[model samples]
Structure formats: C-alpha cells, structure tokens
Target chain A: MGLLSKKDAKLITDPLADNNPVTIQVLGICSALAITAELEASIVMAIAVLFVLALGNVVISLMRNIIPSKIRIIVQLIVVATLVIIVDLVLKAFAYELSKTLSVFVGLIITNCIIMGRFEAFALANTPGKAFLDGIGNAAGYGLILVIVGFFRELLGSGTLLGMQVLGDPIEKTGVYAFGYENNGFMLLAPMALITLGIIIWVQRSRNEALIEDH
Target chain B: MEKRTDKNSYTIIFATVMVIIVGSMLAFLATYLKPQIDENKRLEKQQNILYALGINDNDEKSVVFISTKDVAEKFDKYIVKQIIIQGDKVTEDDNAYLLDLKKEHAQAKDKGHQRRLPLFIGEKDGEKFYIIPMLGKGLWDAVWGYVALDKNLVVEGIFFDHKGETPGLGANINQRFFMDDFKGEHILDGTTFKGITVAKGNADPKNERKEDFKVDAIAGATITGDGLTAMIKKDLRMYMPYLQTLNK
Candidate 1:
C-alpha cells in the first residue's frame, strides 16, 4: 500500500487467477500447446516471456505519445523482435547450451500475441510504470497456467517431472510399472495440451461464477 | 480532432527512422558478438566429436560434455589426425573440422564437384577411432551428429544434435537413451554398407542384437528418427571407400 495504491496493486494481482492471460483472456495459447510437453521447457519459456513482456511494455508506453497510430503494430513488433534477438545473441555468446535449448522458442516469442495484446490494449494508453506492472501480472498469469499444464503433461505423458523419473521405468519394470500402470502417451501430443487447457478453464470458471457467461 | 501521430506524413517518417535505428543496432551487436558466438560453436564441435570418441563427463543418464576451459587441450591430446576425403583425393588438414558440411553437401549436386568428407582420427588407450561428422534434415530443422567407429567399422559411440526439433519428442534425439542405443550397432553387413535403422518396431527392444542394424526409435519422433537413419546411410556410404581401405 505504501508503494502502490489499491488500484495500482490490482493491476499486478488481478491476472494471477481471475484475469489470467491464458485461461481468461485466452492469449498466447500457441506456445502453451507447443512447449508444455516438458516442465523444464515451460519454465524456460515463461521466464523468457517475463523478461520480454515487462521490458517491451515499458518501452512502448514511453513512446506512446509519439508512435504513429497507423504503424503502431509494426512499432510494437520491432520492439519485440529487437529485444528477442538481443536476448538470443547474448545467450548464444555466454550460455551456449541453454541458448540451443531456447532456439526454437526465439521465433515463438516474437509472434506471441500476449506481447502484442498488452502493447495495443494497455500500453498504448497507460503510463510506463502502470504498463510495466500490467506486463508482469499478465506474464505471471500466463506462466502459472503453463506450469500447471506442463506439470500434468510431463508427469502423465512421460512418467517424469523435469526429466526425472517419478513413476517406474516402463522398460525396467520398477516403481509404478510393477503395478501395471502405464504412462499415457497421448498426453504428450499437442491436442492433449488443448484438452488440458480446457479442463483448467472449466475448473477456473466453475469456482468463480463471475467468469461464466450466459449465451 | 486529429492528432499529430495520426498524420500519414508523420507515420511514414516514424517508420523510416525506427527501421534504421533498430537495423543498425542489431547489425552492430551481431557483428560485435560474432567472435564469441563462433568460439562457443567451435568448442561445442570439439566437445561433440570428443563425446562420440568416448571422452566425456557423462554419468549413467545425462549427456555432459567436457568443460569449455579444458576442451581445447583435451581435443588436441586425443585427436591425432584430421583428414578430408573427396572422391579419390585424401588430404590431411588440421582445420578440417571447420569445414561446413551443409555447403559441401550442396556442392555435391554440381556437375563434377565431389563432396568433401571430414573425418577425425583419435587414439585413446592404444585404440584408434574413425570419427565422421554427419548432417541431415530433422522434423523441424537440421539434425547433425558424430559417429565413431573402430577399424572393423563397428560403432564405438555416437552423438546427435539438432537446430530446432520439438522439445520433448523429436528433440530427445540428443538424450542419452537414444544416443546410447546407437552404440555397438554395425554400419556394415558382411562386405556391404548396410547402415543402421531407427526402427519403431524393433524386435529386440533391449538392443542386445548389435548385428541387427537397428535401434529403438523414440515413441513420437518418427520423422526425426527416419531422417537420422537416412542421414547415417547417406553420409556414411560416401566415406565407405576410404573406410574400407582401413583394414587393408
């Protein structure tokens, strides 16, 4: 309360659950489906988006007054692309192995609609400070869902959490495999991610009746 | 009421200026960091080649390469000779590892040009190994690897990497289980070059039959596995003429 007013703090707290980017707004679903097959990749991508979105929101907000309305989308895109390239280059030079793991995601990050969505919807009219808070909140919200989906996908599909075998080895017949429990191979596929996300959306809405809509 | 940013003239000028600034900044950073990036890639190549030749820090599961600070010295200590073979012409070149396989593979289609195959020979514990680099297409991007074989042309060990395969599926080609299965597999059946296949219906799942010319495929990675199989067959076949002369 000392640092931010109630309204300002809500900007940060709102997206964690009720206004979540993934479940509520339904943005950035492509990446959630693509990389959530493993818990580790999901965490890495979430961090990458956190860095890009927070900084991008600030940059766009600072230039909000001067940016031409006609070319605003292009301007927003350039900011995202430039930041991603810088991140990619730095990682390549220093953290080579980590960079290789993130190579596929560099392109994915550029096209993520969440970044564009915030830039156009919030940053275009907000102050840099508020925009930064909004970015963190939304990115955190998106990351929260990604981790949940990834946790189940990796655990059920591969019987492992972050590459560590939790369930028994299927080949060696140890742990749960001794009990005739098999990993669900379908959970690893992209379609399964959609179903998982759907389940999350349903659970989230049912708990908070405000999120439900009557047609 | 029309605003300043809404004007077409201002929009065009803003775009032009933004493009120039972003373009130059990127160009400068890319150029400035090229040396470090290239050095990292160079060390990775040495580590991968050494890993195939069985010089690594791996335990039972994870694939760990030698530290970058020590890779150069270890590379020099283990690799005794580097050579390039083209058609019938063979030449010893210390920098043969720097040769771009993608370019060489492309040039192979030209009228009279032959692809230059770079192979590294390493000696450890008084045993000689022939290490060959292979390049191929993965499900998403380029898949490349190093294969080390003994004088009898039996696979000693292998390493696989990719530019951008699917994270948990196709990307597991680099994982230990998949790469480890490739060990002891034969690239030759009798006197013929019968390269190994990444078989989904592998009869001997434990890979106990080394002479069967097969390794178990990752469950959801059919295309990547097939690409790897074709790569081994295509790339290793070109080096057969030189490899066959080894026993003689």
Candidate 2:
C-alpha cells in the first residue's frame, strides 16, 4: 500500500468497482462467454488476461510518445500478439507441463478486447506505472465476473467445480443428485453465459445507481 | 503545424520499424528457445505414448503421466520396439517416434509419397500394447491422440489432446472420463476393422458394451468427439494391414 500513493492506488482499485471492465464498460464479453463454462477455465482465462493486459499496458504506455496515431491500433495489435507469443514460447521451454495449459489460451489472450480497450483508453494517455495498475485492476474486475458466472454455471450445469464432483457424481445419482436435482444443460451454453453476465450487470447497477443510464 | 509522429512518412516509418523490432525479437526468441521447446515436446510425446500403453502415474480420477525426469527410463523399460511401416517396408527405428505426423501427412499427399506410420509396441507383465498415434481436425484446431490395442484389436488404453478446443467442453477430450471409456472397446467388428465411434444418445453412457464399437460422447463436445472418432478410424485403418499380422 505504501508503494503507491492514493491516486496511483485508485488506478488499481477503481476498475474493480466503479470502472469495472466487464460489467460497466461491457468489454471482453467474448471471452467471458467463451471460457466461463467451467471455473477452471475462467480462472485460467483470468490469469492469462491479467498477465497480458498488465504487460501490454506498460509496453504501450512506454511507446505512446513515439507511436503514430494513424496506425496506433495496428501497433497495439502487434504488441499484444508479440507479448502473447513470447510468453507462450518461454513457458513451453521452461515449464513444459504448464505451457500445455497456457498455450490453449494464447489465441484467446491476443484477441481479448480488454487488452486493446485498456491500451487505447488508459495506456495511450497514462504513465507506464499507472497503466500497469489499471491493467491489473481491469483484468481482476473482469476475472471476478467470469469467476462468479463460472461458479454458477459449472455448479449448476456440470454439478462440479474445477472438475470436482462437489455435488456428487451425476451418473451415480449420489449426493445432490439423490435429491432429484437435475443439472441444467442450458447453463453450459453461451446464451446462459450472456444471461448470467446480464444478471451480474443488473445486480452491479442496482448496487451503484450511477452505473445505470436513463435511456 | 503537424506533429513529427503525425506525418505520413513518420507513420510508415514507425510501422516498418515496429514490425522489424517485434519481428526480429520474436524470431530470435523462437530460435533461442527451439532446443528447449523441442526437448519438452519430445518428452511430452514419450509421456503421451507411454500413457496410451497404460504406463503412467494416474490416480483414481486424474490423467497424470509419469514424471518427465523418469519418463525416458520408464519408456525404454516398457516399450520393447518402435516400428515404422512405410508402404509395407516395415522396419525397426529407435527414433521412429520422433517422426512428425503433420509433416508425414503433408508429404503423403504428394504423388508417390507413402505415409510413414510409427507404432510403438510396449510390453508389461507379459502383456503387449500396440500403440498407434493419430491426428485429426477438431472444431477449433488440430486434435490428436494415441490409442493402444491388444492382439484381439480391443482398445487397451488411449490418450487424447488438442490444440485449441473449447475449455471444459471440447477440451475435455483429454480428461480421464472420456479417455478411460475407450479401454476394452474393439476396433474391429469381427475381422473387419471398424473403428470405434463416439456416439451421442446411443443409450450407452456406462460404455459397458465394448463390442458395439461405440463410446458415449462427452456432453457439449460433439465436434471433438466426432474428431476423435474420425481420427481413430482414419489413422487406425491405415495400420490394419500391418496390425492384422499380429493375430496370425
């Protein structure tokens, strides 16, 4: 806490609540829908996004002064791609087992709207340190929603959490299955992810009325 | 006055410079890491092959391969022979396992190029496992696996993996539940090599009826299941002529 002043600290804290990337800005919904079918996937995606977003923001911020505005978007895209590939290559070399898990997310990370969103919105105008914090905050906030959705989806859909049969084996008809509680096949689908995300947005807006717009 | 960065020539130069820097950096890193990455992949291939032979460190629920540090020794101990069948010119090759299937597939497509098929024959407790490697297309990207069979052509064990299948859905192909179900399933329907099918709604969730040549498909993974099914059929059928000799 002492390492950051209040202004810099807000760069980290604000996105977790007020400027929440997924819920408020509604960015990165693609990945939130795609990977949140399981808690493990959501967690993996969260970590992947966090790593990319933070490092990418710092890189973009450092280059902001010299970057030509005409092709800034392309530059951002290239940067993201380079960073993701470099990380993947390093992981494959040093941590072979972990690389297998992370490699699957490489394409997902490079294409994430959140990384681009943060680069254009915050990094282009901010210092490297502030952009890094903002990246961490936004990614965390996004991950928080993904984890929530993933929890409900995996719990209800598969009757499991992180592949653990917490509700007992569905096939064996033990534990919760004994209570005649059936798993909802719909929860595993993308529509359910959208609906779950909508519910979170609704709840978040209710908690903070400022998040809602009078249309 | 236009800023230095805002000029047309500046934008082009910036683009060119960025590309060169990023490109060289990436190319250099890839080159530097090639050895280690290739080593990891080699180790992984051994682990996957051994896994299909049922020589692993798996538990009640997980698909844990033998540790990398000890895998080379264990692979040598279990796998008695490595054979390559190139259009009936079958021969023993210690390094046959290293043959890149992707390259072989590409070459085989060329005129007069016979696909070199690598097979590992593993021996444990006086039992033999004829392990075959396969590659197929999943919904998102390439899906591949290794399947081991006994003399009767019944699947002994299997290991499935993918490049970019959907997590928790299609990617569950590598999970224990899906891979374990293939065990004891026959690849042949009475002298005819009929590869096993991942049938959905076949009323066989338990996979007890191995003779039916069907395994219950993973829920929400229709494409990956089909890919695995096709991979087994396509790749295994190629080796039938050579495999059929085992029974004789």
Task: Show how many residue pairs clash in every candidate, following the order shown.
Answer: 0, 0
Residues A23-79, model 1: lDDT tens digits: 998999999999999999999899989999999999999999999988899899999
A104, model 2: CA deviation in Å?
Answer: 1.9
Cα lDDT tens digits, model 1, B1-248, are 99998999999999999999999999999999999999999999999999999999999899999999999999999999999998889999999999999999889889898778899999989999999999999999999999999989999999999999998899999999899998999988889999999999876767899998999998778999999999999999989999999888
Each candidate's chain A: what TM-score?
Answer: 0.97, 0.96
Instruction: Compute the interface RMSD for candidate 2.
Output: 1.0
Decoy 2 TM-score against native? 0.97
Off by over 4 Å in 2: A1-3
CAPRI-style class, candidate 2: medium
Worst 10 residues of 1 chain B by lDDT: B200-209
Give DockQ per model, in order. 0.78, 0.79
